[model samples]
Target: MNKKSMSKGIIKDILIVAIGVLAIWIGLQVAFGTQNPFYVVASGSMIPVLQVYDVLIVQGHEPFEDIKVGDVIVFNRPSGQDRVIVHRVASIINDDPKIIRTQGDANPASIPGTDFPITKEEYIGKVAYVIPQIGYVTQILKPPMNYIIIVIVVGIMIVKQISKKKNDKGLNINDLFTKNNSEQTENHFSELDTLEKDKEYSTHVESKPLDEDNSKNNSDKEQK
Candidate 1:
C-alpha cells in the first residue's frame, strides 16, 4: 500500500477501537446500573481493607434490598454528591429509602456531615474484587494517555489475529506470489484462445470465393 493509504488505514483502525472502548464503557455502566462500576480508591478512607490507589471492581447491579449490613459497599460520600466512598455498612438504618450506616475501616466513627441513613440511589456498587495498587496506573491512563494505550492495544490485537490466521492457514508470501502467477498464466492462455478463434474466423472470411455464380457460369460456358 502507498504511504497515504497506509496512514489512513492506521487512523481508521485507531478510531474504530476508540469508539469500541467508549461503547464498552457505556455498556458496563448500563449493565451495572452505575457509572462507577470500576472505581479507583483515591483516599485512605477504607484503610486496612482498601488502601489508596487500589482498584475495585464493583460486582453486580444488585438491588438496594440485597445490600446487607457488614458488606463493604461503595457509595457516594455524600448523597448525589458525585463523590465515591468505600466503607463497610455498619447497620441498616431504614428500609423505606433503604438507608444504611457506613463507616470507614480506619475511622473510629462514621464520617461527619453524612446523613444518618444513606439511600440506595447513593450506592454505586459493592466491592466484589480488588486489584491492589493498580489504581495508580489506572488513574494515569485516565484521559489522553488511555486513548493512546487503547489504540496501541488495538493495533497489537490486529497484528496477533493476522499472525494467527497466517499460522493456521500455513500461508506465506510465496503462496501469494504463486497464486498471482497462476492467475496470470490462466488469463494469458485465455487471451491466446480468443486470438486463435479470431484468427480462424479471419481465415474463413478471407478464403470465401468472390462472385461464385459468375465463376460457375464461366466454367459452364467454357465447357459448352
Candidate 2:
C-alpha cells in the first residue's frame, strides 16, 4: 500500500481499539452498579489478606443494610483528608441510618474517626474480588513512564511498516527483471531457429540446379 493509505489504516485500527476499551469500561460500570468498580490498594494495612498494590473489584449491588461484621469494604475516609480506605467491618455501631466500625488487620486498634462512625455516605462498595499485585502495572504506567512506553510502541510500529513497504518494492523490481530476462532468452532461441531453417532452404535450392547440369552432360556423352 501507499504511504497515505497505510497511515490511514493504522489510525483506524488505533481508534477501533480505543473505542473497544471504552465500551468495556462502560459495560463493567453498568454491570457492577458503580462508577468506581475497581480500586488498587495503596497500603499494606490489610496485610496477610491484602497487600500493597493488590487489585480490588468492588461490587455496589450489595445493599448497605446487608453489610455485616467481618466483611471487607471500600469507603471514603470518615474525617480528615479525602481518601479511599479498604478495611474489614469490625462492628455494627447502629442499624438505622447504618453506622459501622472498621479496622485494619495489621493495626492494633481502630482510630476513632478514621475507623468508626462510618456512615452510608462514606460507603463505596464491598470488596468482591482480589487480584494480587496486578496494581503494580498501573503504578508503573503512571505519568512519564506511560508516555515513554506509548512513544516506543508507536515508533516500532512505524518502522516495521516502512521496512515492509521497502521489501515489497524490492520484490516488484526483482520480478520485473526476471520477466525481462525470460523474454530475451526466448527471442534469442527463436532467431536461431529461423536462421537454421533459412540455411537449409538455400542448400536445397543450389543442389537442384547442380543436379540438372550433370544430367544434361550425361545425355550428350551417351549421344556421342
Candidate 3:
C-alpha cells in the first residue's frame, strides 16, 4: 500500500483498541458492583489510626455480637440515623441478658456518656480495608479534579494494554517499513543479473564488426 494509506490504517487500529479496552473495563466495574463499594471517614471518631479521607471497605454484617472487641465496626445510634460510625469495641453489655455495647478508641467521655452504650442491634459491618486520600474523590465529583483523575488512570491502563499487545505481536516497526533483508538482497542480485545480460549482448554485437567484412558489405549495399 501507499505511505498515506498505511498511516491511516495504523491510526484506525490504535483507536479501535483503545475504545475496546475502555469498554471492557467499565463493563467489569459495573458487573462486579465495585461502584457501590466505597467508604468515607466522616469524623475523627477513630483517630490516631484511621485518618480523614481514608477509604474503608464495608460488607454486610453476619451478627452484631459476633464481631470481636478489636474489630472496627460500623453502626448507627439510637436516633435511627443512617450514618456509619467506625469505632473499636471497648466493652460488651449484656443488659437484661440480651445486649452488647461498643465504645470508641479516643473518647474523652466514658462509653456510656456521649451516646448510650451501643448494643449489638445497632452494629453494622466491620472495617475491611483503608485507602488514604480516596474519600476526597467521593466528596467532590463536580469539581473537575475527580474527572481529571479518572481520565489519567484510564489513560494509564490503556497505555499499558497497548504495550502488552505490541509485545505479544512481536511487530518490529523498522522491519515492517523496510522489507525483509534477505528478500531485498535477492531482488538486488536479480536486477544486477539482468543488467549484466544486457551488457553481454552489446559486447557480442560489437565483436561481429559488420563493416569490417568489405565484400560482404558491398554485396549487402547492392541488395539494399
What's the lDDT for all of these models? 0.59, 0.66, 0.51
Across 79-164, the per-residue lDDT of candidate 3 in tens digits comes to: 45545567666555664543545544444322332234566556556664454556677567864556444434444543554567
Better of 1 and 3 by lDDT: 1
lDDT of 1 by residue, 62-167 (tens): 6768988767777765634756667778888878867789866444345433423578667777775555565566556677766445434433433454567643
- The candidates, ranked best first by TM-score, are 2, 1, 3
Query: Model 2: per-residue lDDT, tens digit, 1-224?
Result: 99999999999998876665566556557756788767778875665567677767677988878999878899888886378888889999998888999977655446566677898888888886565566676667886544333333423433453477543332221232346577854564345423322222233333343366755865675699
Stretches of model 2 off by over 4 angstroms after superposition: 143-224
Please list the residue runs of candidate 3 whose C-alpha ends up more than 4 Å from where it truly belongs after superposition: 1-37, 95-98, 111-115, 143-224
- Residue 26 error for model 3, in Å? 13
Clashing residue pairs for model 3: none
Cα lDDT over the full model 3: 0.51
Q: Using alpha carbons, what is the TM-score of model 3?
A: 0.44
Ranking of predictions according to lDDT: 2, 1, 3
| Winning model by TM-score | 2
TM-score of each: 0.58, 0.62, 0.44
Clashes of each: 0, 0, 0
lDDT of 1 at 71: 75
